[model samples]
Target: MHLQEWLQLLCSHTGLKGSESEDLWSLLPSLPSFSLSTSSLLGLGALASLTAYWLVTRPRPMHPPCDLQAQSVAINGDPNCRRSALLKDENLLEFYYDDIRTAYDMFQRGVKITGNGPCLGFRKPGQPYEWISYTEVAQKAQWLGCGLIAKGCQLNTQQFIGIFAQNRPEWIITEVACYTYSMVLVPLYDTLGMEAMVHITNLAEMTVVICDREERATSLLENKEKGLTPKISCLVLFTDFSQAFAERAGKCEVEVLKLEQILDLGRQNLKDPVPPQPQDLAVVCFTSGTTGKPKGAMITHGNIASNASSVIKILEGSFTFQQGDVSISYLPLAHMFERMIQLSLFTFGARVGFYQGDITLLMDDMKTLKPTFFPVVPRILNRIYDKILGSVTSPFGRALLHFAVRRKQAELRSGIMRNNSLWDKLVFNKIQASLGGNLRFALTASAPISSTVLSFLRATLGCLIFEGYGQTECTGGCTFSLPGDASTGHVGAPLPCAMVRLEDIPDMNYFAKNRQGEICVRGPSVFKGYLKDPEKTAEALDSDGWLHTGDVGQWLPNGTLRIIDRKKNIFKLSQGEYIAPEKIENIYVRSVPVFQVFVHGDSLQSYLIGIVVPDREVFVDWAKEQGFVGSYQELCQNPDVKNAVLEDMRAVGKEAGLKSFEQVKDLYLHPDMFSVANGLLTPTLKSRRTDIQKVFQQQLSSMYNKTAS
Candidate 1:
């Protein structure tokens, strides 16, 4: 029987009417259909008959001891719920079991979970909006899960399936289906060059890879040339490949399956039992590998589910929204941060609208969705802040505006007004209008954001922009600043059920007090281990299960955590003075019109050197205002431009209280900014320090070659 027919029969038998029946019926249109043998049909009929009998004879309402109302708790200092709410339930494994079962429950409860939208790609443009719904998502996941089972995917052992692609519905569906089947998903950044891609694939021992498009399909197929191909028996393409690439891929001697084909195979057998418990590994997200080859962090279903549940609980306390709140999902799903947030949205039954394309079109997409929530990285926020500040052309106007902003920010911090000021309304109201004016929070991560930008957002946007801290191993968020706790440079307290402690390294000066040291964490949200890398896994996670985060951090008196710098990135100069370059660079980047900044002084005698990308428009405008008659190219090499940056750097250094040896003394201008496309940055937009050091090795050497000549 079709899903609609089955739903009709069930609803009629139950006497469901009014809004309840309508709600249930709305969920049916998107469900997938399947063919069953007479015997199997009889068996399912018997189960359904029993279910209906129980429903009719059992208690009315059939509500659990707990409900959504009980789940709502204030995230920012509400004493009532925080004092009484339980973090975990009776079952030890309940956390893991919740991941897949909750999804099924939500579907049964008439939630619209997923949709198909117009491909609306970045590289390709001019496509109309096409969409897929939640029913389609659930059915497709079951189909894909069944297909994997049919293909002899091991129920035991570490079976890895790689998704080497960009953001798409297929990526999310495949991951969900894999979770249902207890298969570990390995998500690879599409921007990874061949070497890194091959290294990660081999390390994970992925047997099947779901490529996002023909480009990724071709890249993975060509990996055979590097002699790195292992038991990778299947290559599934999420997009249709050209006949030319297909023919060439066929020559490579690997079997290829289109995404639709796999889904079709699975849909043919939809009633198969859901496999595995939630504690089972669900994904293996690779680290950015700033130091070396990336290691696959084994994030389990329980870890993901727990994190999502925690975030949902926290969000409910501050925001008032129902099962169908809207969100715009544009960040890469490959990242743990986005994945966790997306999962949380699913649990809440939010309508997730995909961005039309890159962030350049994010505002346009926002206008369409009028999203209540937005997840972004610091780079995007920094750019927005810069653009807003740069718009004030007159120096006097800028000073007056900054003064008003500061006063308004102080008023906001003091809880004077929860809304925008009159001056702010007059000045920056259009800025708010551009964002659809429905934004509840701007969630930022991936790097430390500046206080100036954060303050400006809160004061002007009249919405909280919370900062969160986590790694791939922690299933996204370990700590998040509460809406009311938007203090400068604070990452906030650890989430409930998460245990964090610092391991003091005496040699590290930053960790000298307040239990400052390498941040080590142990929690239900922590990953199981690295995929097929026991040695590295052992090195990272201890026997007792604390994962050494490699980040130096300190706990403030208020219980918030502040990250000092990456342990590996802190270097000592020839004078034996340790320099935390990331901290210095972050400050300078905030103050200067630089798109990217890197500070280096390793083994150097005295001060630091910097490589910076000038904010082209701002730099040009500044040059024109200063009476410099030249183009951007000439301005880039002009002494005046260098002097401006140097002065800004010096000012920032003075404000930050840096010693002479720690200050930036020499600098170079970069013609281009670091980006994922150029192999200069990770997919997350973090600069690859090693790569940058190698590329600028000569220039770095030149800084010290003349002994201060």
Candidate 2:
């Protein structure tokens, strides 16, 4: 009860009205116990008032503060080198499950623990989500593993099983089955292109390919006809195959079978499982190849197992994974970040719901599942941030929104997190409801998110938004921001299995002594090596086992890591001023019109140019507001629209404090976007700069010539 309510109740029980209560209060000062010197009475009253205020206004933190001072310890008296606080003398973290060493082992443990609990979920067009229990999943995976063995797949660690499809129950089932039978799993997606797919298949010497759709299966046969993949002898379809398609496969000298057929074969001829050892090869995760051809990174069972276990150990104290926890799987399963998340969930027997193979329906899926754990990328978060801010059309409402955010952010710094506050109910409740209103935790990776967006989401969503940093070669994540950390612009300290240090990048003017240089990670979670490429392996992993990450970073005083620039993606202008296009592109993409931006600078030129793909909806809306009428393509080509977008980009750049030379002075607004499907972006959404430049060579040349003149 409130203080006023208590006082009123006391007065009613004592049979005293307001005036009578005031008289009693007035008499207390003149009572015998209060008959003291005036100075003594005044000092007692002051102390009581101070005590009451302190009791009412003191901070009530909800979670423990991150020990920033002890975040990492220097190694061998070198302040520049560091390791995780959880580590002891550089020893790697053990697996979360004592006996579980591989991904398949994790499923078995889940079956033993969660039993009939839902493991995988899917939704039909008009139905709610249907779930497959852990026991059922285990049985299906067993049958599938034996079926592959019966179908002439070698039961050994070197046997490569390729999966080329979107994320689904079948995709994960294939992955678990491959690990169950001591086979290496190679994941391929549409973004890899036909040439890269064929190259991966041949490089892995994969004899069988499993797919979800008919087009994917047909493409394999078509590629065979083109003499690209001669070794692939079998095609397994998760969906049904028509007799005509079976005949077509037979004519192409390839065997085709449905999923049910394989399960039946396995049921008829059940064999003992051949589990993989810790050192056995588990996956040949291929890089998306932003610079060159996709190279397979050989990940052993122990590598991924240790990585997942280390991550879980670090998070368990703050956000423990439980059986009832649910997550939406929408990010490409082909990416290591998503794969690691799924693996971690499996270890804890959590449920995973797959999207309907459509990213546009992700919010629909989230509403249906009401997931508690949300794993996202920065692109999705940025869109959500923009959409919510765009909804408040009035200046006063926007101002109020900003003010509310500031208030909540102040509470966040005091370690308080609550959603029932006045501001949360009035201003941010609807914003939270858009994400299913049950997001207890979220991890944003794959790219750096702005501090404004991160802090805003933390306050509005009422969840711990952890920022993580890693690469495919490190088996997913190496560093993750702490749970209670409110600071932004850093990826936090290293995980227990990862010991990070900086190496001098002399050309970039970054030095280890200055706590700024190329980030290098060394640990048990690092990949064994690049498959079939000794030169690249040697380049990535030095003799001391440190994986040299090409990104430049600075170690903050508190031991967190802040990404500064792209060491490998930087270029020099004619005036010898170095330009980092990625940093500029990141800033320019924040403009309302731009959806994707490719900032380009020529060493022969003094200024930069950009190829911008305007956000279709926002750009069209803006054009209509300006009294302009044209088709989407026509609007893109309109010189006035192009100039307006360029000006907006310049405004954003100026706000971000970009150098004059770094800002793009000329721009070509393209109607088409740089995407993975177009082979202009990697699967991770990083720009394939060489391919993008190739695609717009003529336009780039025109822009440069005009700027030069």
Candidate 3:
């Protein structure tokens, strides 16, 4: 009963009004369940008074006075990095951002406020480079949109346009032009060869393609004549505006326009450009298919805008990015990853420099540009690591590098210095200046990075190396490393706008309960399924909106994700034990002497076999020490050398916690490393297991026969 009701009953039963009752008795409830002694009642009153005082005067536990205070600008609901409730149970890290829907929307707002500052930087032959302001970029897009409309290009009617070129200022112009007219962009990578380009153009049914050079235009024309891409109706050349350009256009029997001509045409007919709807198809990015034909992923404007905003918010939470911050662009803009970075840079009006076709000149470009931000791939980072350490051959030099690293680590651990002055001056500064004196951070992606390499770069260079993991269908890195992420070999966490979950895969024994399964994702960042291939779409995406990323993943102890292997790559042995060959390969390849390892074992085989490619430099030194010096090919033919490397491989497997059955019994040394040109490696530097198996079938068979004998 309530206190007031109980008091009334007591007054009626005792024949005493409340006014006549003793004031001390008021402390106790008058209900039959309350039988408080006088002393007990006094104690209860004192406890109540203490609690009231504490509630009124005590400091709030959540907002205690501290030296470091959070700075947040509230956008939408919350602008700070927040715990995403969708992945809260899984403990995935993510950030919340301003609610923005399309790339055009963000660019429109940011450009108006930032004004006509430098937005893009490009190099010219035998002359000084030039920078295009945000005003020019937008104005050029408007003109291009007008020209496209004048050429009978349909807006928002799913007109696919192709960009058959490398990174350039014109590429950005073409992209914004396409977006302004609601044309779906189909970016063709230069590395994808002419045949892949023709096939993609055919599949995409491109109305017009923009080419930066004459060579690609000639190939596209030849392919068009050969009926590879019959739907291609026009070619707009950015350069080469001579009679030959017109001749090529006429010879191909297609309407051709120079980029300048298009811009002028648009200038004559310029009007207010149509703004893109949120649900409009932004781009159709094709996957680099290692197994078969590529599939086009239909990514929408919402997808790009949402992902860009999330990453922007993430960068803001970690560090500061101001207007005119320089970013080096060297990776293929045709790839969605680079394109996403380019699109995201608009939010801060960051100045981006386009790298010339030559990779050898990247360092020069970096030194000249003094880029503050760089998104590099693993192969590049690995190359940088080797080039710096390659000269540390003397024992004294190696010991010094080691000692300095240890000292720096110790000083940081003991709080002696916030930034280790000794390492910074003697070691890191030179390395940092080599890339660019102004580099604040760098990103690594495209393939799995060795944690050893990742850790060494951070330790020796004293810079933050954030690693990201994603696929084309997932709009590039759905998960990126956070500021405080210390773990190696893990993708940081899903983007804040995305919801990720682990789904069970029973055949290979992957389970969500074990925090290991096929990674399934659902969010604004996810694509709108494959274009023109509903069957493939149905297989990849389900009714529940989860896109089944064929990759198998495990959550680290701290909730970061480690990609274990492709689901289809796992194989079983005759002994009925499942073996993940990729996992074994990942560990075994980390050995300094081992360059590339492709672990192979059939369902009928008892033990795994490895095709090992030894690091040639290390192999030569070891060979010289053994007094068996010869060419690399001669050393691979030697059984003793092969056995010695095989023994080292076995030790590596054991250290990685592989079972005895999973250990490589024998190895055949490959004379050369796998490369994309060899058809054994993907463009992203991933080994194509099926291709490798085909190439080494005879060698593997001989190894197994020798083992059996």
Top candidate on lDDT is 2
Which digits, one per residue and each the tens of the lDDT, describe model 2 over residues 1-709? 3334433454565566554567545544454532446676567556645544554444456553347656777888876678777676767675767898887787777788799999999997556888999888878888988999988999998899999888889888889888878999999888777888889989998889999978898888898878899899889899987888888888878999889888889888888788898889999899887777888999888888888888787776667889988889988888789998988888888999988877778888888888888999898898888788778889999999999999999988877766778888899888888888888889999888989899998888878788999999999988888766788989988888888888898877889989999999998889999889999999999999999888888889888888888888999999998888888888988888898899998888889999999987678878887777788999999999898888889999999999898999889988987777778988788899998999999999999888777
Backbone clashes in model 1 = 8
Please give the lDDT score at residue 201 for candidate 3: 86
Candidate 2 residue 94 Cα shift, in angstroms, is: 3.5
Candidate 1, residue 292: how far the Cα is off, in Å = 1.2
Q: Please write out the lDDT profile of model 1 over residues 1-709, one tens digit for every residue.
A: 6556666787788786676567666765686676556786788678767765655543222121123223222234421112112345322122432434433343322233334322112223444334556666667778887887767676542778788776767777787677666677878886666777888888777778888788777778778645577667788888787888767666766678888888888777665546655567777788887777788888776777667655555555455444546667788877888777667666655656677547678777776666677888988887778778877879987987787778767766653434446766666677677776777667889889887788788777766677888888888877766545535777766665466667766666644344578887777788888777899899889999988887888766555677877776888888788877887888788555567888988775766888888887687776676677677778778867777777777787788887777778878877688887777888788888998999999888887774488
Per-residue CA lDDT of candidate 3, range 1-709, in tens?
3445444555555455343444324655553454556676567557645544544443221211111122111123322222232233433322233445676776665576576888889885444457998889899988988887788788873888888887888898888888877788888765566767877887887878889878878788888778677777788888865677667668667788888898999999987777787688889988777666678999888888767766665555446566757888888776788888777777766778888667778888887787888888876787777766775888887888878777755543332322236567776777778877777677888777888788677666665567888888878877777654445778766666565667788987888778788888777778999989899999999998888888888766554577876786677899888887777887887665687889999888899888998887677777676667778889988888887788777888788888899899888898988886677876567787777889999999998898889
**By summed lDDT, which 10 consecutive residues of candidate 2 come out lowest?**
1-10
Stretches of model 1 off by over 4 angstroms after superposition: 1-129, 394-411, 414-425, 511-513, 624-627, 707-709
User: Over 4 Å off in model 2, which ranges?
Assistant: 1-66, 620-635
- The stretch of ten residues in a row with the least summed lDDT in candidate 3 is 64-73
Best of the two (2, 3) by TM-score: 2
lDDT, candidate 1, at 400: 76
RMSD of each: 15.9, 6.4, 13.7
TM-score of each: 0.81, 0.89, 0.81
Residue 77 error for model 2, in Å?
1.9
TM-score of 1: 0.81
